[model samples]
Target chain A: MDSVNPSSKYKDTLSLIIFIVVVLTAPLWGKFIGAGYPDLLQKFAIFGLFAIGYNILFGLTGYLSFGHAVFLGIGSYTAAWSFKLLTMNPVPAVIFAVLLSGIFAAAIGYVSLKRTGIYFAILTLAFAQMGYNLAYSVLTPITNGETGLRVLRDDPRVLDNALGVQIDGSPVGNFFGIEMTGYSGYYFCAIMLILGFYLAMRVFRSPFGMKLIAIKSNQTRMEYTGYNPRPYLLAAFVISGMYAGLAGALMVIVDPLAGAERMQWTASGEVVLMTILGGVGTLIGPLIGAVVIKYFENIFSAINESGLHATFSFLPEWLENIAVTIVSPFVGDGWHMTLGVLFMIVIIFMPGGIMEAIRRLTAWVKRMRG
Target chain B: MEDNYVLEISGVNKTFGGLKALSDINLKVKQGTTHAIIGPNGAGKSTLLNTCIAKLVPDSGSIMFAGQDLTDGMTPHGINQLGVSRVFQTPEIFPELSLLNNVMIPALAKRDGAFKFDLFKWLRNENQLQDEAMHYLDDLGLADSSDIRAGSLSRGDKRRLEMAMCLIQHPKLLLLDEPTAGMARHDTNRTIELLKKIKEGGMTKIIIEHDMHVVFSLADHISVLAQGAIIAEGKPDDIKGHPKVREAYLGTAEL
Candidate 1:
């Protein structure tokens, strides 16, 4: 029961250095090899933010939320509405999205946190489905129905008007002189992703975070020690929701559309899958999973059956077609089948996820070096 | 009636369905004394201890600690904040977290209220918190095993670590549920010595024990329970010689 020594300060500094390197170099790599697929990389970074936030609740608290996509959808819809009605400035729109998501999360968390384990997961899923149904039918007027909402050239921007600029098609009206497209948009999300990572790291190291772990470990003991665990659990849920909101806002900023599909339970399940694939609870694991999954979805899906056959033409014709047929289901719309198989394998063989496997490998290497 | 009496339980009754787990259990322990509750099997010793600490609510009872009516509605976190801590019969340390972190939890909660949302604050840089935790671990002779997982500890070591966790909170009342329930004789002796040292160091403790030798050696006041009622209460010698106590325990053997 001795005091644990502080983890090496250099460990954090080193991680920061590595993060900076990756953020700076990734877009450049995308530019060189992705063949006009910078959007793919940007989308990966945005979803990486979402997955990281989702992991805060799922990985750390040992609570699996199946409706996290509702927060993401709410954030996107709120930001879209803000841009359409109030202002076209991305700053306030993003802030409003995050705040709205926080309020939404608080409401869901307060109700859902009364139950634990599978019940809690079902409650969250039920809420998310309710949100999805509302967006699709009940709230069609505000949410613009299944067709979603869009910003037009005539949309009023009071701030832009007050600043003596034209309301429509003006180059001077960019967000702090950086256009919300291409590299600038990618950088904006990349910066926010780093900040989100920093905040999550802080929570991981905080006493409140430890209390969440305590609740996860022995909730009965936590109660006996005089803690009402509901508040802590709710707080974690809300913070995670805000993270989802930021990612959602970034999505609308990059492409000014918010659809009901974003709120679907499948999106929620995708984030969970990403987190588990990369390593739930590890700092960079979810981000890695997000990038990997999005990369497959965006780039790998473009490789159709004919594309596979063209690449494998050096082999015998029968062998080439057989190889193409064998791999066809995993290339295009069937990519999800491959993802499902990969997830099952990971769950069975590496239950701790890829991050844990990496950690074990690193420990073994260190032992050998020593 | 002493000002420093750490715990005061009056008219505490607990009924589980049709059975009375505890009934009208009134007890008080002065500061810096080792109070022991002993009883035959099913005597409600554990239930009484649980009720005092708000683990189980009594149907019609009040528990006062440090001059406050810490009755049925207060939670365990609420009681811990009022300077009361408990060690369970089974080792309840965080199995995955290192022993150091397990002890740090209660210590942190004691220092930083019942709840704080300081998600960005660094726990390691909290110098005062680390110092206090280290002091308790040093006293418990667990300084060497601080980084090891608490679940991996020997039974005797886990008990010591659990005690250390409770002690670090600087509780006014320490409730131990069978501190030596499943230990070897040597380990039991060591636990008795630890309790003795804790009492000498000015911490009030209430121990629920079945071991008569340990009870007689340490208790300043003894309460014997039988079938959910306090059948005898006195000095250890008086309870040992009481005819009813013999009948409850020895069952026809002459004392």
Candidate 2:
């Protein structure tokens, strides 16, 4: 393990500048583009936050937690409840969601961190399943059972009532003189994503983060160094869980519905795919991966075989039929299968994910230049 | 000599099911001196180091460090916080981390306590830790490779880097397991010279070694173990002449 040098400092600064520029322009691009695209972008941003958070633990510490969706689900459920019961203000809802998720993560992490490697992952998966079951069966009144929780129109916003006008079904809550919907909602999620990204970047550079890498490399050596691996693992797990919570809260803010499916194992698996696809341990890779996967899910899933056939009409009839037949399995209902194949290809051929491939290409180019 | 005895072990016994790995091992390590523990295979040299560092709990024994009773089931982190650090037989550096971050980790752990939740703070701005890491890396001739990933280093360089990592904590006691086990003769000599420099810098070290050259060149005190029991303990020259030590080595020729 080495420390940051002056040269890498310049690279870091340049990357940060590029990141800021892209973030600043994302909303502008979103506003000008198709409405559905912006929504997809928002989903991408939220899931990116989720995946980045997951990577902090899984990527850094080498703990492959299988129950991370519990945190996200908890965040969504808590945020929805806060909005429906306490207030409609998104800030409080997000804060409540994060706090609740953090507490949940801490408790689960405490028990799970007692085990290492596969056992720790199993513990997390079991806890997540427990949470999922609870949300479906026992927590029916709060979670609203299979139908899930929705923000009712009659939910009282005391702050709005104090102003003497009933603001029912209106997305017009002024938070410090700013609307909390539309552009405001997007900005809110984007800001949170940025903050989460920044925090993760800091952790990547920190000494504690180095300890995590060491623990990942060799647990026995870490023990001999006088460091207990459990606490560090637990802390990473909680931090990652909290990030998932924030993502869940953002999910509800973008669309105020908390479904039981949000906490499902598949949801957890999706984030794992995103992290691995993007490049685990690389700061920007998860976000890019999240965008790519969500883009395919939303856009590719909508394109039917007929639609593809019509689009490719310029080709010869028989060739177009063959192309459509070949491509049909990759679109619509087969999108997940396509993703699975893509994941396998990337894993086998480009084990470091897209970022590493790009890094290697750039290094190769530099060598050629030399 | 009173303050110099940083590590005191007595009646330390470790058993795995029906077999005893270590029995009644008593030892004292003086500050800034290199104390070497040598034994043939299965002599429990690794087990003793593990017990001292709290990786494995001794069944019945006491380990005292700097006036603190560390044998009361403290965690490895707890013992590390008490100013003790160890290096493995193989290089255990973080393969992905830069060399500087590796050294900085233990240094920060030593300075900032075992665990910290400074989530919102930037760690690189902690000038004190950066300075200390740099100082240690410079001492071990690894400052030039501070930015390189530790796994990319040559074997000799990796060993030096690991040493730098252990030293950065300014530990009162350092435990090294086979510091020259897999090195070439030149690399072993380099490691010996590094150990000599470390000792000259007033760092107390306990080394578990098989290479007699490294042991003889660096150890001020030597302890010989045979079949999990210490058979000889004295100055290096005295242990070298012990018939029991010779017999133990001769009996374990297959090792």
Candidate 3:
């Protein structure tokens, strides 16, 4: 009918390859050069999945949610219950996590999407806060309050008992016979992260995804064009919520506990920080954001005065002391200060986040080479 | 009555806090003709268009389009489904998307109703809709800019892309709200030529325009509105020298 245009499938394939290579080598990166990665690396993959999910809703659709953590919490709680009631197998837990979280998200998104902009954000936040409070106080029978719902030795795990309790000391989440703990746990999460990224990529390129982004760009335009975005938005909300739940289940599979603290408003805010900090709309940006924040939080904060001294030992004593004094605030108990400064600097200089900064840097280097 | 007229507005009244944006306005566009509503500023041309498109509900009136009573809380989406496509005055579009994407969305909306889960469906699988959208884009002379971001287009091009988006639906009734506003002469002429080409297709057109040149050249019938009411209604030649129409335009004394 009309004319022609170029396509972008090849670029997507290349990016997918790069993503797989980098994530598959997570255990071999820098300080993680040992046989088994510290639990922190698992945190990277887990929260990375969560942030990717959040990006689908907020970044792709422009639905800024202040309560996505509730999906993760619901997932965590559901996984814990599955372990205690039905089985200790990670498969059942992951499936249940996604299913229950999706149902809950649908119910909440239906109500929240009635209003848009700040009001939508507030509605989701209120729903999440209510869920958190219930888990902390009212729903203690199910959530088990602050200590959270954990599997005990006496839990009537029907599936496990039916198969006969062959393992020692309570139960461990397993896939067939392989335990989901230590190195295996990291491996499990890494695989899930890769799969999640692939699915997210598909969504980004799909017609449905285009509709969501259209709604984000101009809802009024979309309406006049004969597209009602409500059902599509609700679907995206549920899908992303399922991703959060999957991450939650993975967390429990790795650590075997779900706490009320996991559902707090701060937790929701943390995922928001990760999504925006990496790059609001870029595919790989949320993962990078998750890594940066987790690295600062779990690893950098552990750097003590002696650790700082070792790093700056080559300097003269006066300069070394000064370096330690300055660096110390950015590490240990004051780690959040480093993050705060980073957030401010990134917002001021690169409002598009780290991904934009990286893009510019690469372009500059390319120019220099030319 | 149903066979002759495509849009019928009866007893429509809309008041914005005593401003009386539109009051008791009644108009009918015969099937397959280009009808223009020409009015001075503040004469409620835009307001009446908004009410017809369901962007604003008339305080009291019935909008009947394609045998559907559209006055009962019908949404814009609902109105659009009845084969009514509106070209806004300001050229509203999905600015962040590619020109191809901007066109494809309307095609898909026509094929897939208001919403479809369609989450896993590959973009490549939408070959039919894509081809249709490309046809419209090419028709509008925007095939070369198909891959460019819609927001990056010039004002004229953006308006053209918006028309391509609306045209894909093959709407039975097209409501254009000042389609040639703020355009260079070349673009305005190009638009008029495009409209002339579309006129052959026999879709009823309702154009609310301030540009008398466009109104006289393209419109088969013209209605002159002022102070929230139609001051004159006749063929373009008849309306040109109508006494009340001249009075409204030049604010001449009754004598």
Candidate 4:
């Protein structure tokens, strides 16, 4: 077995506590940023969980998988089916989503992992694209095509029926009679995010994680060191896929919809951006990345010309108009442009991402203090 | 089935297109001995070592390492797990990891087999393994710099780090492909001393070296190769005096 210094163990515990406090208090702090809404908060937790898992494979093993969304899609579909056929409860839905997505991830990973580098990435991308097409077209019966898979009022929820749970209206995801909606949903997802983050931390500090880093640093050296890289890579891929599945399951748990678009390549690309934007290899980087991207997509994209105009009202009328015109392309539907520019800046200046910037800032502070 | 030889390579032949890399190469490395293979560039020294580690599959012939047939579809890690390890010419250490991690990783691999899930176990709790890793770092005179990234080390230090990596595994057959490829005179001498220290442990080593001084100092037995075939094999002094070796390898340069 491999071992680290004891001081780091204390550091890990401290970081976990800080992380828990921050996540649990998101709604309170979120109010100041105009992001106190339960739906957006729920998204932050869900995507944060997704990115944390992606970091395991992409961050540690350096396997750039462009097909993770398939697992997410699989998770959503599995959860929706569980809701429709089995129960209205989130527990069984989440379990089925994780297991099914893990199986899919295993099969896909086994095929894609045969090739490394760009080929491996392309292979994963191809598998996800294929899955998206199937879910949209041929597999429409199960996936429900463009309509998406959701629990219907008339669908037989055998478990709920057997448990004598009363459903007066449309089915809502419930945890023992407590509806998974609004604050309850956000808290549920937040708890999962915290658990996922803890698991990711465990992976980062574990010996297996060290080997994964070793694989990233020098795969040839790792093989020569008597380690078979395939098993490790596959395990990471499956673990991350399960994470994506959990996130997908949570998406339905909050709203109960499974769309083929969730499996699209762009969705896959989003998680990749989230991982890179936060910090590729660092723990908590992916969550920050996910939150940042989701924040931009939700909050920043909602900004309109009037909002920009209001902010720039202090300027002269013509200058305010010009400022709004210049900034308009970077907000609303064009928020991607802002994200693109931010990504470029981060890549060029702080290639390690926001976490790296934070690290450097702290280091600078320490240097000044000394 | 079992003999004093730790490694027995017989009638091994490897070819790339029409070119023969190793043609009917036959050599036996005894247990607890430092055997050196000295040859000019492209003389199949690295090729033979790669074949031994299953990096390159030979077109023909068999390599038996302590009753295990290496040529019979054994993977590199499988060979390594069977106490066979190799040091590359470029010093293949995990560049981004700390020097201590560079040492500890192989030790973990050796102890934990090819794969183990130990996801929740704290690496800080593995006190014995960490101590052993620290001891090896101390052995290589790198204890003070164990926390530094392996990539930031100088070329000679990287070589020493690689040696520490291999040594911690305590491999029965350690194949080194030019262990002192790019080093100053003093660094080369220091590596020779390190190898000599390990030689006291009675671990078998096959060193492929270009430097005559390193080969002569450490190798109890020497094999001279020219054009993918062994021209001479004997005690180090006898290998130095061989006419074919002097002409093919030395090329009129006095050793």
**Using TM-score as the measure, which candidate wins?**
4
Off by over 4 Å in 3: A1-7, A30-38, A305-327, B250-255
The true-versus-predicted C-alpha distance at residue A168 of model 3, in Å, is 0.6
Q: Candidates' lDDT values, in order? A: 0.82, 0.81, 0.87, 0.91
Question: B136 in model 3: Cα distance from truth in Å?
Answer: 2.0
Measured with C-alpha atoms, the lDDT of residue B209 in candidate 2 is 89
lDDT tens digits, residue span A256-316, model 1 = 8889899999999999999999988777889988987887787667888788989999999
Ranking of all candidate structures by their TM-score, best first: 4, 3, 1, 2
lDDT of 2 by residue, A113-203 (tens): 8888789878988988898999999899888989988877777656545555444454433344465566666677778888887788778
Colliding residue pairs in candidate 3 = A2-B135, A301-A332
TM-score of each: 0.94, 0.90, 0.95, 0.96
Model 1 RMSD in angstroms: 2.8
Candidate 3, after superposition: displacement of residue A215 in Å?
0.9
Q: B182-222, model 1: which lDDT tens digit per residue? A: 77888788778877887788988888887778888899888
The 10-residue segment with the lowest total lDDT in model 2 chain A: A1-10
Per residue, candidate 4 scores C-alpha lDDT tens digits across A1-370 of 1123233767888889999999999999999987898999999999999999999999999999999999999999999999999888899999999999999999999999999999999999999999999998999899999999878888888988898877878888999878999989999899999999989888888898888999999999888889999999999999999999999999999998899999999999999999999999888889999998998789679999899999999999999999999999999989989989989999999999989889899899999999
Mark the regions of model 1 whose C-alpha exceeds 4 Å error after superposition. A1-5, A31-36, A167-173, A311-322, A367-370, B2-5, B250-255
Tell me the chain A TM-score of model 1: 0.93
User: Tens digit of lDDT per residue, candidate 2, span B133-186?
Assistant: 888888777888887778898876787788888887778888998887667787
Candidates ranked by DockQ: 4, 3, 1, 2
Quote the B-chain TM-score, candidate 2.
0.91
Model 2 regions more than 4 Å off: A1-14, A27-36, A168-184, A312-326, B1-4, B17-19, B200-202, B250-255
Candidate 4 wrongly placed segments (more than 4 Å): A1-7, A309-322
